[model samples]
Target: MTRLGNARLVLDNEIRPGGVVFAGGLIGDIGEIGPGGDGLDLEGDYLIPGIIDLHTDNLERQTQPRANARWPSRSALVAHDAQCIAAGITTVFDALCLGDIGFGKARNQTFEDAVIDIAALRRQGALRAEHFLHLRCELPAEEMPEMLARAIEDTHVRLVSLMDHTPGLSGQYGDLVRYREMRRAEGLAPAEVETVIAELQGNHHAFHAANRALVIAAARARFIPLASHDDATETEIARNAAEGIGITEFPVSLQAARAARARGMRSIAGAPNLVRGGSHSGNVAVIDLVRENLLDALASDYVPGAMLEAAFIAAAEGAIALPAAIGLITSGPAAIAGLADRGRIAPGLRADLVQVRLHEGLPVVRAVWRGGVRVG
Candidate 1:
């Protein structure tokens, strides 16, 4: 058995000084608030459940490290897995886009390569963190149905999010001028930018409703949980709730988040948004939602490290207690993803935990153990 003691245990409801013992990949016991452990000594640091990230674009970032610099798929997967482990994440749902919305033609290729790379790495025992696929379906893309058909066949896919990123999508991206500027910054000529925007809008008008129904049907058929992305209004949230979408990912406004809560849906915000104090795109702030009791979970989104940092930041900001803040990245997300076996410090649960020592008010990850095996 592995006995780790002298640490602050972030339990489901509160934080207390305690220890836990584990063996055979399961927590054998949780006791010993005082010192006297036979194995590892935590030495007064905070010990919490390993983070469970349900949506992250870190794989895509790793796959394309720089502009025009696409790395090998398997190599990028390995690198991403290492990053996740170091970030104290035990389970990660890699959010990959299935449909190309003209801005990123490589999304389709990235999705395909990631599926194959994840499987290969798992077979070879090369992954440190548990990896799963979260398919991000762009409803306006014409190829979404065809690509989703191939994607859902893979056993790794566990979640699907419906998105409509048609240029100037009202909620999260209401600034059409900003949209055109961003595309132009990407080296697109002004005329090309306009042309692409027109094409995207046309596709959205033609296929958004039909493709949405198809994606919802496919997800329901497979029993995969559905997330609605960047919802802006109560009506949009109500429509998603009626369609049986159980999670609202990155709600764009307070109205949308309140609607999700009213419908008994989970609301996930980006951890980076909380850590940075506001949304990058000028949407509803995460702290405001926390004060309103509207935010349910926090995902890494693009930066895996933001999960741990955001939890501590939340606690420091006096919005919530440390244990509840930790839940935003751990238990809350795990519950949203329907992962019942991990995400908490308790007897008989998987021993996926993280050790952190706060330095200058910043949580620093010191160690990580997944299923009772030290990985970082």
Candidate 2:
């Protein structure tokens, strides 16, 4: 048995000085009382559940680190897995895009390569972190339903999100002019942006309605949890809730977040938005959602390490206590991801844990353990 003591155990509701014991890849004993058994000394660092990242685009970023560069898929998957483990994420749902509007055409390639890569790596025991797929289906893309159908037939798809990234929609990219700016920022020439925008602006009307129904039906048919992306209004939330979407991903306004709560759907906010204190795209502030009790979880939309940093940011801002804030990255996400065996510092659970040390008010990952084995 391996026992770790002299640590602040971050529990479901509070943090207490305690110790944890593990055997055979499961938590064995735990307590807030002082330790008596011979064990490793933690020096008062915090012991938290290994983070559960429900939505992360770290793999996309890994595959295309530069504007014009695309790395080999197998190599990129390995790198992405390592980055997730180092960030204290044990269960990583690599969010791969199913279809692209224009600028993110690389999504098609990523979607094709990642499933094969993950399966191959897992079979070889080459990956460090546990990996799953979160298929981000672009509802406006004409071929998205087909893409999802092909994806679910082969890969171990865990979660699916319905998205409409077409300009003039009700969500983040609604403004056509701002959308043009973003396309240019993605290394598209002005002429190319306009050509793409002209083709896409009114096309959403033709494809979105049918695509939404088809995608939702597909996900439900497989019993995978569904999330609605970038909801901006009560009507949108109501519509999505009616369609059986149980989670709202990054509502752009408090109205939408409140609507999500009223409809009994959990809300997942971007950790980068929370840590940056506001949305870079002018969406609802995550802190406001926290204050209003509209937030259920925090996801690392782009940056993996932001999960740990955002939890600390939430705690330091006094909006919530440390242990509660930590849940945004751990237990809250685990619950939504339908994982019940981990995400808590209790006995008879998977020993997936992270040791974090505070440095100048920011939490730094000191060590990470998955299934009672130190992996980082």
Query: Which candidate should be chosen as best, given TM-score against the real structure?
Result: 1
Error of 1 at 27 (Å): 0.7
**lDDT score at residue 332, model 2, on the 0-100 scale:** 92
Model 2, span 240-311: residue lDDT tens: 888789999989999999999999999999999988889998778999998888988999999999999999
How far off is residue 222 in model 2, in Å? 1.5
69-174: candidate 1 lDDT, tens digit per residue: 9899999998999999999999999998978888677788898888778888899999999999999999999998988887897877889999988887655556
Looking at candidate 2, the ten consecutive residues that score lowest on lDDT are 31-40
* Predicted structure 1, TM vs. truth: 0.98
CA deviation > 4 Å runs, candidate 2 = 32-38
Model 1 / residue 78 / CA error / Å: 0.8
**Would you estimate the TM-scores of all the predictions?**
0.98, 0.96
How does residue 225 of candidate 1 score in lDDT? Answer: 91
**How accurate locally, in lDDT, is each candidate?**
0.89, 0.88
